[model samples]
Target: MPLITLQNVDYGVGGPLLLDDAQLSIEAGERIALIGRNGAGKSTLLKLIAGELQPDDGEVRREGGVRVARLEQEVPQQAHGQVFDVVAGGLGELGAWLAEHHRLSHAQPLDEAALAAVHARIDQANGWDAQRWVEETLTRLELDGEAAFAGLSGGMKRRVLLARALVSRPDVLLLDEPTNHLDVPSIEWLEGFLKRWAAPGGATALVFVTHDRRFLRALATRIVEIDRGALSSWPGDWDNYLRRREERLHAEAQENARFDRLLAQEEVWIRQGIKARRTRDEGRVRRLKAMRAERAARREQVGNVRMAFADAEQSGRKVIEARAVGFAYPGQPQVVRDFSTVVMRGDRVGLIGANGSGKTTLLRLLLGELAPTSGEVRRGTQLQIAYFDQLRATLREDWNALENVAEGRDFVEVGGRQKHAIGYLQDFLFTPERARAPITRLSGGERNRLLLAKLFAQPSNLLVMDEPTNDLDVETLELLEDLLADYPGTLLLVSHDRDFLDRVVTSTLVMEGEGRVGEYVGGYSDWLRQAAPAAYGASSAARESAPREPAPKPAASPRRKLSYKDARELERLPARIEALEAEVAALTEQMSDPDFYQRGGDAVQAHGAQLARAQAELEAAYARWMELESQGS
Candidate 1:
């Protein structure tokens, strides 16, 4: 039997039904990705399953003793306390006792009596198991139990919330947009944690809604989609689902076309007035009326956002140049250290780092918006810039979307053509009504779309976007990717969407840590492959060293004999090889230790990756060394 089943559920509020007799079953060990466009009822369905909301008509059946837990999309602003106490809140009454005990025990003036009473309650309730589970979950998610919850970054807070959910050890876990603010590493860690949390053959189940294509691809075993107030299940990975969904949509369209043709014929026949009424069969007339009703009730698939950039004159060949650029705030550590690069026209560069890393700072430095504490930043001539701020600070939240886009003008110029502001907004899937609505009335996705419409309307030779992919639907993201790929301008993008990075960026600049940044030739996946040699550090701790990050690893050009690049490669190989050997030896020693195995699968896998990377790097180093030696001879 399934852990949870929704049978012919109907739900909505005031408007069209968000769930029209939707049925779904979440089985054991299935990793289901609940996917849909913005406001397509994905979160609503999760609420229904989580029992946080009730269906207007129909049953949301759960197994008698089964447990369900959910990690909400947004981190609670009010969640304040030690990480342990907040996570303990996942458990009900017993958790309150544990939390009280923890609080009383930790009080500056230890309240022995209150602590004793809470401890007695915990013992009576058999809360020791819950205590242990909380600790284990915190450790698993790399959360510090004693740390302040409010002090954590957005990504870290998400992990803490996830830990709270996992502490319950529920039969089913529901996550909504779990990867929203997470960096690539954190996302990868979450993916691994979820896979380990459940089994492929029905041990524990997971249902999540996410816009991160890479995360969805990595974790989802099955896909559940909401469209036109209906639910459909697709069994397979993302690629498989895409192919099948395309075919399904194509068939649906063809069938709709045939039905419309018949409906049109019926309408024409009915328009014959007295002649048709005299011969019309009662059944035929009834069928015509039913078709009209069906057509009226039919909900069409939402249209894709039609995005286009306003045309601008080409920028100078070198869009931006930074020479030994360094920046730091007063009484703070360096946010950028000796970073140098030339951003040429038409070069699309992606900036990636952990949540707190200084991608935004680097962007400002490159754009010359902020003067570097040291070094020089120069911009080329005729630099028309269009910036998409991740914070959406450019948006006028108090104003309506149409006013925000058009300001006082009745029409906005896009791609060298004049278009009415409302009509242009419609191109981005915003109806005239929605366009006229205040910005605050739009959902996160809609706000993002409106921001895009406004951003793209500005003519530019360079586009700088920071975290623009957040809260955007996959279709819009893909559309943006398409637009960027064909764009003829210098682009600097800071985004954590790994798939988006891979699909759109031509190069990457990653902040390793401690103000050190490394540039790579390709996107996030490429960075992973290229950074496999563990350039940042042997371990996470060592990555924070305060040194100017090494320049991009040098590559040798094709030559009959030893070239200057070949000599440079030869010079670096011994040290590279030596470092790899040391890493391998250290990893090997750590793995041999009996205690290493007790750290769990995460540690073991990490060490395995380290060793594998070391060996691969060693092998490559040796190959280059031998080739250089031969060339010298």
Candidate 2:
């Protein structure tokens, strides 16, 4: 059954239409992902569905008795209230019922039987172990153990809001940017919870809006793309939607090319006919009119932002290096300790950690904006740096886009060279009219893109960007990714956008608490694997020792399933084989040197031959890995 329906919804504030005659429907068991650029009315559309805002000229219908719950990114705080009180506020009628039961039980004249019945009702009103469930949810979001609701950070506050929404157990769940400001584990937990909540026979139907690519890939059953104030449904996840969108764009481009060629031919014919003054000149004019109409029909203009980073000159070998780095705030204890990393030329490094884990502070220390209390910060010669902070306060509110880029100052070089402001803003996808708008009037996404444009245009070889993808539109993100992928300079980016990190950075610099930096091979997934043992898996004492190395030759074969222990053993097989091969090689050299017979008895000779045979067998066994990899790939 359709849970909520919007019919010809037109939402606007005063002057411009935000969403124009948009229609959308939600049904039971459907997981819909709402994606669009920031300020493109995604939040407004959610508000419309929640009935928090009235459409200008449309009707919204909800199924009778359908309870919907919405989670806002900015959770409201109440004065003179405890943490449990606000979290329990979403219980509504159930809370009222429980309170009534408590009142009756506390009465002095209450009968024993009635008291017992009221106690049972109270327990039933709350879910099974409801108090424990609430506590667990709060703890998972890192809101417990000295982190109270009023004392929480922005990211922790978002988690508390999510807990409040989930505790209600509503029929429809409306989550706006749930993955925003959440750590990887929290995101994974939320994904699992959402999936379980939207399972068959569950009350909730999830409508999740997020920019996290992994969350979208894991939770979305269908994608609803909101472009230009309109919504279109796609069959699968974000990856599939991207593929289909690319194909559609390619087809449109081809059609435009074909139409352009035909129009060019028609233009030549019209020109030739006018020169010759042919008998069919009137028909030729009609044909030209028809050609103009066809061309008008084929010409389509889509509004999109284009941004690219400016090139940087080569820097020295040691771009940045820190030794015995230690940092702490004024009142708090040390956060980063003895952290050391070498960022040379052509290194794209990612910085990953949970919220309040000093990732940003570490970047600041590397940039030399904040000095470490007891360590040395070293940098190579002629190293230029550009920083992209999430707050995007670099832009001046009073100034226009062009003037903001110019920074309200002009300097002429010795040769009288000058730079124009409008040309620079235009490079960052701003037109003359847009460049004229005050910076305060620009949207969050527009401001973020503008900041990026300015950062890239500057003469910088080493870039230190912190949460660069926070408010950027998807188009700007892709463009930035492309530019960074091709960039020859060193990048030390701290971002939560997994797709962007994977596509742009080469290595990740993890800032775990206690001022330790652990280097892991590969990308984000690799770092996750290395960190998983500590964060999710068992203790190191339970792990097996390193195994022997493997031989090199293999062709192809079939794979066989292995149990947990068997898999572990299989991992060691190659290393064991390599060790045996090395031993065999050493024995062969010793035998040729005529020292083997003199140093040992017949047992040594027999042992050497047996070792050679065992090594060959192990090599053969290790060769099966190629087939397994092929199959897995």
Who wins the lDDT comparison?
1
Would you give me the overall lDDT of model 2? Answer: 0.68
Per-residue C-alpha lDDT of model 2 across residues 1-633, encoded as one tens digit per residue: 467878888887754466777776676666789888766788888888888888889888898998888997545645113445455556665544443454455568977787677567757766436545555655655455223467766665666677677666577888887766666545666666677778533345788777777678877756777765666666434776898778877997898888789879878776775546554468767877897897764424335554445555689988889888899888887978887878889899888777777888888888888999978889888888887877777777777877766666542111123445565566566777888888878866678778876786576788878777765667767877897887778888887676777788888887655667666655666565445435332223212221222436697565556657656756776787678677766654443332332333234335444654766676676666554444441
lDDT of 1 by residue, 1-633 (tens): 567889899999767899999888777766889999988998889999999999999999998888999999888776779999889888978877777887787788998888888888888888898898888887777788889998888888888888878878899999989988887667777877787887554457899999998778777766888998898877536886798789989999999999999999999998888987899888989999999999999889999999888889988998899999899999999999988998899999999887878888898889888999999999999999999987789998789999989988998888879999999999999988889987888888888898899999999989999889888888888999999999988899999887899899999998888788898998866776656425332223223321233567668655466678878888888998898899877766564343443354344445555666787888988988997886773
Where does candidate 2 stray beyond 4 Å? 10-21, 73-81, 89-147, 254-304, 310-313, 328-333, 409-420, 426-433, 530-633
Please name the candidate that would achieve the greatest TM-score relative to the true structure: 1
TM-score of each: 0.83, 0.70
Q: Model 1: what TM-score?
A: 0.83
Residue 614 in model 2: lDDT: 66
